[model samples]
Target: MSDAQYTLPKTNSGPWNTRPFHRQWLMRQANNLFDFFEAASLNPKGGFFELDDAGKPLDGANSTRQIHGTTRMVHCAAIGSLIGRPGSGEILDHGMQYIWNQHRDTRRGGYVWSLDNGGVKDGSKQAYGHAFVLLAASSAKLVGHPLADQMLADVTEVINTRFWDASRGAVKDEYTSDWSKLLPYRGQNANMHMTEALMAAFEATGNKDYLTKAEAIAKLIIAEHAASLGYRVAEHFDENWVLDKNYLGNEMFRPAGTTPGHWLEWARLLIQLWVLGEKRLHWLTDAARHLFRAAIDLGWDKVHGGFFYTLDWDNKPVMREKLWWPLAEGIGAASFLTSYDRDDYFQIWYRKLWDFADNHMIDHARGGWLSELKEDLTPTSRLFVGKPDIYHALQACLIPLYPANGSLTKGIIEADHTAKIAH
Candidate 1:
């Protein structure tokens, strides 16, 4: 396909696409999440508490504080403050402080995977968690958190030196805290998130280098790996970045076969990367649309309205349960397409996905969205314990309210600037 072919035609939008009520609705959804997580997430000792189904703090010391949760909490709060939510600064500051004080490996170099009451719960360093560290730090920096500068610089150094595999145009998978015994495994999930973090870093710092790495990773994964595989988004790979079809390391994190959700995620991330790159890469938008269509084709439950958690090599559902994050990602992808292409196809999906989330996944009375649902679209807890996170759902609401070309941080800042000009 020629580069010009990627100039997808824009058109008149429908109510779902251009309605004023939807923007207000999106803001209300975002604020609901901000209020929910902010009220219950903080742990006095260091990071966030593990909340149960009712939003009550679950017993910690018994479990672990994964780096993703802590970092995402900071990210969620940073975006909150960007939207002018009061008390969000404290949440962002507290989470950033906890990340440095607890998750950072002072003994070694990189951040650890998880933490307990005393210290290091699981000391292994993972690209996935570190990617979020970069994301959170970039977000905190965007909001002017006091610790943002040091945290951002520290994580940037760790990612560049440790995880980044310059040869493959992507990052490596995992390592021990001592920085020895590197895991031979490679996966796109971490790298997918790294693309997101890199974009956030670019938006926060105006660093073209971050965009360079982001474009490399997006090309390697979406334009190359995913394109070759019918845009299915292979989850696991060997050290050489070769697909591991039989690799099912963990049911939750590394389930067997392709994760449809990541397809939606990469779709949006690819669009953002392309936008940030000034649309020089025509293939990024094309691949993003392909990935979005593939997610709906292979991941969506036909009999149901939500997306499946995983699918086998045969394209049949492996983990048939519906997940909240996929719906969140689907909303994100659809909304971006709605904004970018302005076509009713994507605009329709945007409303449909959000409608499905509202009907099934969102627990209106309980505060945050339900984390899991049965294949039939009823709430289920077989996979998750409680209302674990607000990042995905929160972003689902906020992304559509902002520009398609930037992170929520940039979106917030730009919107505020525009408002000031209007005033």
Candidate 2:
């Protein structure tokens, strides 16, 4: 940790605001992630392919693609297009076309959960997937895709009518296609993402409704629920929106215990939400701080250099495997905290996170990030196979490069605008 590679950033111990080397380093890393995914993610079939650890499409992979998976690639591709990554517009165009043509359930209305070989694999509509749809539409709108307006409008309508529970200040979970039953399950993960998508939508369109909905969700989930639970960011819930402390469903999405990574994610997002709200909102920044602190104190492996995936109520690690996205989220959260408050706390964690990623999570030989590591900091694939998705990793690299006041798209556009005027 004391070596030059992991040393504290900057020429002096002053504020990192003036530092350029780390931002430049972040740009390089961001470009590497974008290149790795862009070169191999496009699946001329419909959506993007799942890339292996070496950044190639997984062999014998089922042509099945989750809607969130497709939408995230589109969202990241829009970021690429905005940043002038070559052939990015094509990626943007390809993804938008796929989502409109294949993912959408034209007869039923909202998007389907998953597709296989261009057909519906799971006709179940999920709030999680639709939130990503809104996110993809918002990012595409930012990049000026031709279908962006129509797609955004359509997804927004679907969300408002099908998913939004105005009474609860959040969205309901899953539904069968044809707009059937609402599953008894309710979860914060979908609402967390909806907060993210809503902010992006607001950024792209200046729609205060989106921002208002986002704030409500944040208040309900973070300010009310997680705050009551000590900022651990509860994952599972019942229909009445009460915490289902014993509920354990899927290992990947709806795991049993609290996911610290999501706390880190919410920490970064709350800052963005507060800034996007023109800093008019109260309690968001403080909540962000608490969430960040809780994740670090409860989740990080003090014996090692990575975060445990999940933890029980007693603050013990439940799923002990180290995951990549948590570290990615941690750095983004750290960058935002560092930017808004002059606290060295976030700046310090930001560097330490990068150190961990550089030494353990990044596959320098393969040109993409390693998906997971054991508690001992060795690479493992039990939980995440391949470089599952680039959204988290890409944002982790790019978020630190720009001001944390708005969504990443806004950060890129405004920063680029400033750069152009400066030159």
Candidate 3:
């Protein structure tokens, strides 16, 4: 490795603070990843392709175009475009067209989970994918995509009418393609993403309804569901919003037991809610801090330097494999907390997180982060192959550089204008 490649960031690099240096470094890293993903992942027709370690398409022509992946690509592309990155608008438009043409269920009224060359590989309507659709549209709208407003409107209608549970203040997990029957399970995973999507929608449209819904879901997860379970956020739930800790609905997405990565994710999202709520909600910040601590204490493996994939109800490591998303979320949560409060604890954690990611997760040879690792930090593809999407890792690098008091889209917009003024 080059001397610059694996060097750990020091907390005391300067007399005052090394945060500014960290910010500049993070911007370069985020931009490099933005360019890398745009170049390697976009399919010719539109949308993105999941690539293997060698940067080759995993599925060739018959690759399954996932709604979540497509939306995440658009989200990253929108950020890149807003930040004045060259060639970003092309990828943004490509993702937008792919979603509108291929993913959206024209007659059924919701996005399908996946599409292959033969079309409609998994036609089941998933709230997770739909939430990403909302997020993508919201982001595209911010960057001034031509169809973003209409797309946001359509997605909002679908989510409200089909996935939302009016009484429970949470979103349902899944539905049949025709929207005839709700699925048997409910999930905080989907609700968490829904909260993220709603926040982005609120930013894009100034829709108070979106903000209100996002806050409601945040409370449901952090205040109620997580509080009841000692702040270890439950992933699966029953139809009535009761926790189902033993449920393994989907091996990849809704695995059984609590996911520490999600707890950290909620921490960051709660911080966002606290900020956009005009700091009126004091509990949101408190809940965010609590969630961060809970994840660190319960999920981090002392023997191993990374967070475990899943923890059982008693806090034992359920799946010992370390995944990349948790560390990304950890960096975000710690950076956000440190930015808001100037807490040295979060600063230390943030530096440690970057160090861990630099030493283990980053693919020095290829350019994207490796997605999964063994407990010993060796590259492993048990759950994920190559780099599926850049959303989480890119945000991990960029969100830390911006002020913690607004949505990421808002921060990027402000930074973009500031850069233009500087030029």
Give the TM-score of each candidate: 0.95, 0.96, 0.94
Q: Better model by TM-score, 2 or 3? A: 2
Clashing residue pairs, candidate 2? none
| Residue-wise C-alpha lDDT for candidate 3, range 1-423, written one tens digit per residue | 422134334646321223577678788789768766888898886678998876778988778898999999999889888777899999999999999988999997989999887788889999999999999999999989998998999999999998888798889888888888888798898999999999999988888999999989988888887887788998887888777777876668978898999999999999898888888989988888888888888898787789999999989998989898999999989877876764456766777788999899888777888889999989999899878888999999888766676778888787667878999
* lDDT per residue as tens, model 1, 1-423: 422233333453464535688888888888888778886888877788878878888775445688999999999999888888999988888889889988998879889999878788899999999999999999998877888889889999999999999999999989977887899999998998999999999988988989999999988887778899899998889999889999967877888899999999988888888889999999988898899989987788888768889988889998889988989999999888777774456766776788888888888897889999988877888988798888999999988887776777788788899999999
Model 1, position 123: C-alpha lDDT score: 93
For lDDT, the strongest prediction is: 2
Which residue pairs in candidate 1 collide? none
lDDT of 2 by residue, 69-147 (tens): 8899899999998888888888888888989999999988999888877488899989999999999999999888899
TM-score of model 2 relative to the true fold? Answer: 0.96
Superposed Cα deviation of residue 140, candidate 2 (Å): 0.8
Residue 274, model 3: Cα distance from true site in angstroms: 0.7
Q: Poorest 10 consecutive residues of model 3 by lDDT?
A: 1-10
Cα error, residue 421 of model 1, in Å, equals 1.0
**Predictions ranked by TM-score, top down?**
2, 1, 3
